[model samples]
Target: MTFPAPIDPPARLLMGPGPISAYPSVLRAMSAPLVGQYDPFMTATMNETQSLYRDVFATANDATVLIDGTSRAGIEAAITSLVRPGEKVLVPVFGRFGHLLAEIAERALADVHTIEVEWGQVFTPSAIEEAITRVKPTLLALVQGDTSTTMCQPLEEIGEICRRHGVLFYTDATASLGGNDFEADAWGLDAATAGLQKCLGGPSGSAPLTLSDRAVEVVRSRSRIEAGIREEGDASADDFVRSNYFDLGMVLDYWGPRRLNHHTEATSMLYGARECARVLLLEGRNAVIERHRRIGDAMLAGVRGLGLDVFGDVAHKMTNVVAVEIPDGVAGDAARQAMLTDFGIEIGTSFGPLHGRVWRIGTMGYNARPDAVFSTLAALEHVLRRFGARVPVGGGVDAAAEALT
Candidate 1:
């Protein structure tokens, strides 16, 4: 049998919307020697990680923990655990991720209701309130920042609306957490979930999530009932969550003081997650967010100065990603290929409605820097010109440099 060669890979600047370059320290953290899941040191690390992410979420909730899968897992866990079958779930659809939330809720046997805006626009608070009044769903699941359309939906006022309507509020922050402002408690989020791969400067796999006391009450209700039944030698689990793997209550117990074993922890991912939070907190959370904001603005300016029209409302776009219209007469995929092959840089292709019409460029995590921004701008200029598009010789880099200054 033939074996593949040792994993040698090319070095490419990841300027696309996600899974950007992980921090070097985070990579090293994964190489640290593993230990037993219940070892004292391991448990302490887990507890410390929970505290670190509390500051990251800007929340005081004691139920904060890490989910074993990707950000999607966190989403499913929060939704399924909180809303039992046949409960009403309202999802505000702005882009692809919103649709994902609705689909997940539907699979959880929820009576799903949806409200949508145009791809590039977001819903007004009043619109959401109106929907809540009409649909009166038990839960409102929304996406905070969706990379698909480069839109960050304003969540502050909507939380209050959900509260007034007595609806549980949850948001998927996978695309926006580290790069944009997110206040879980202050914003009255009943549940919020995020992944490390975006602005956290780490690889995907570990999903950090937090739950409010109310959400916890709902989730633990099932656990209490199921545990009681199990102790009585009853095998029935009619009241238990459908998914054992993504069950947030079980995950919380494992992360909590009980140390109730669920699955064996992903030791390396936990290390990487801990280092990611440490790096963010060490640098100061607000400072890292500012860096993403600065670099993202520069990338937007660079694209504009390079003679590209940006997609979506500029005011609502996230701080780490921008979508630029694919210039007429230039093939989108071909230009992206040239950017990769010639310059060893990768910018993203659009998703859903924006596909083939625009390119999504990201300045996130470890790659959100002045040098990375300028380098991407420089390469983009060459690619656009080679594709027979009219672009200024140094317009992109010059504009980005000016923005940085």
Candidate 2:
């Protein structure tokens, strides 16, 4: 059988829920020469990356580090290490990703309890607090932004609530960080994890994570020395983390001064993650978030101008992603295909309850620009019209441009 010729892929604009176009600098950084895992330069680069992500996470926690896998790896690492078997964990489900948190916790053998709100809505702080009080959970795990519904759960008050209730709090900020407001220390979050593929402007290989002192203590208590490096006096716990690769205690040690052997770090991914954080910090976190807000507003206005209704509560929607209802006459998949084939643009489809009902469009990372937003709007309008939807000519682009002004 013949294999494909030398690699070549079509150039296209990614305007989907995630895995958006990475910043050019991030791509370049990943192409740099590889270095030995414990090389002085490599360790220094890792430390610098940690420092940069602390600013990105808006925290001063010394436990901040990168997990050498996708964002889900960080999520599992935090849950598996911090939540021992039989521990109660409360997850407030608003959309698909909230369910994901519960699933991960369940796999960790946690006594996971979940409270549900509709997919397009978020849990109120009071509602989540009530659940916490009733369940008396050891940890409250939630997602800050669930791209499935384009809704961002309000975390500021929830964090405070968890503190009052003596429940450790963790949030997956993969889709929200960099383009939204997240204060790990200020909000009292015990642990938080993020990915580079969304608003951070990089590919989806590295997970940036941060843990407060309290969360670190929980992990340290369960720390077990790796077998190869185990000494007589080394610490080990009876109930060690289930997954070796997803153990935060060992991961932290590897990233810390001990530099104990764990997995061989993904060096290229480290470079990309470092560059992603560096670019965001250089641009100023607040400024980058505001840019997302403006671009999101423009996109929202453009879709509305095309006579499309938005899903979920507009006030609570994520700044990076917007879910627009598919018009009655338009075939969602066909329209998406037309946009991709004819205009070289890609938008997202929905999941679960929202499937075939809304198109999840993203203005995130390097693609969160006025030109990108405008082009997407224009292309979408054309597709909708061709599919027999009554979209106003030029209205989408016009509204977007006006919103920017």
Candidate 3:
């Protein structure tokens, strides 16, 4: 039979929101030899990975582990496991991901409540507190970074609000964890989930999650109470989490000292995920955040130097992504395609309300460097000129260079 050629895709500088160019070391880790699920080496690697992520999340929680799917999988695992059917889950909507949280919770059969701030804006702690007081939800599901709007919601104060209201605080930190400041323990977070594709500098197959003692207690209570009911044919409890694969109780046990079996470990992805964390920690977590801040700032300055207006409130923008308004008469998708097909660059476009109106450019992960930022701006300047936008000769690149220095 005729065979397809070796899969070779074009080299792209993925300057979009995620799945950015992973670190060279992380790529190498994925190609390492595989091992048995129960191998001592594998278990030790798992323990080491958990330790690395504790440093990454800035928490000492013993329940840190990886969810074996995309960042969305991590989000689902957290929501489905924490919220029981018909229990209230409060979601404050500010962007596309917020709606996703509500949708996930609803599918889990939680009574989902959502209050909206306008797109491009974030909810204040007082706003969240008021809602928590009124709705009295069992859990507060929030997105720390919403790339669709390029907003990084301030989580430090919201954590306190959840604590005061006796609500479990959970955040989807997939896009913001390594790039911004996330103090899981200090922020009073009960649970949090992150993906390796963003600032962690890896592919999207693995998600790092951490659960505090308070969250772990809740998970254990449900699982322990319903442990033997299945065998006794007494389905009366109905409290076991709806999913075995996503059940944190089983997942924790698998990662814990018991070495119980759960999902067949995706060994290669784990390797990549571990390396991602390792590189971040080696460089120092705060240093990585500062790097992202510097690069993202340069990108922002570059766009404005090109005479582009930024989308949303600049004060609340993420440290890794900036949304710039598409110039009048410039076709958004055509410009994006030109950047891809003509320059092999991939800058993202907004979703929903902001779609076609703005371009979301990201400086994150391995691509968050001055050279990458400069190259992208130079190419973007050419693309803008092609679309008949009046772009200055070297305005973008010059501005970005100035910022970096």
Name the lDDT value of residue 68 in candidate 3.
98
Over the stretch 1-405, how does candidate 2's per-residue lDDT look in tens digits? 989899788998999998899899999999999999999999999999999999999999999999988999999999999998899999999999988999999999999999999888988888998899899999999999999999999988887898888999999999999998889999999999999999999999899999999998898877666444344344354367767788788899899999988889999999999999999889999999999999999999999988899999999999999999999978999999999999999999989999999999999989999999989998998899899999899999999999999
Candidates ranked, most accurate by TM-score first: 3, 1, 2
* Best candidate (score: TM-score): 3
lDDT of 2: 0.92
Candidates 2 and 3, the one with greater TM-score:
3
| Candidate 2 vs. true structure, TM-score | 0.97
Which 10 successive residues of model 1 have the least lDDT summed?
224-233
Highest lDDT scorer: 3
Error of 3 at 188 (Å): 0.3
Q: Which stretches of candidate 2 lie over 4 Å from their true place?
A: 1-3, 226-238
Model 3 pairs whose backbones collide: none
Candidate 1 wrongly placed segments (more than 4 Å): 224-227, 231-238
Report the poorest 10 consecutive residues by lDDT, candidate 3.
224-233
- What is the C-alpha lDDT profile of model 3 across 244-308, one tens digit per residue? 77888889989999887777999999999999999999999999999999999999999999999
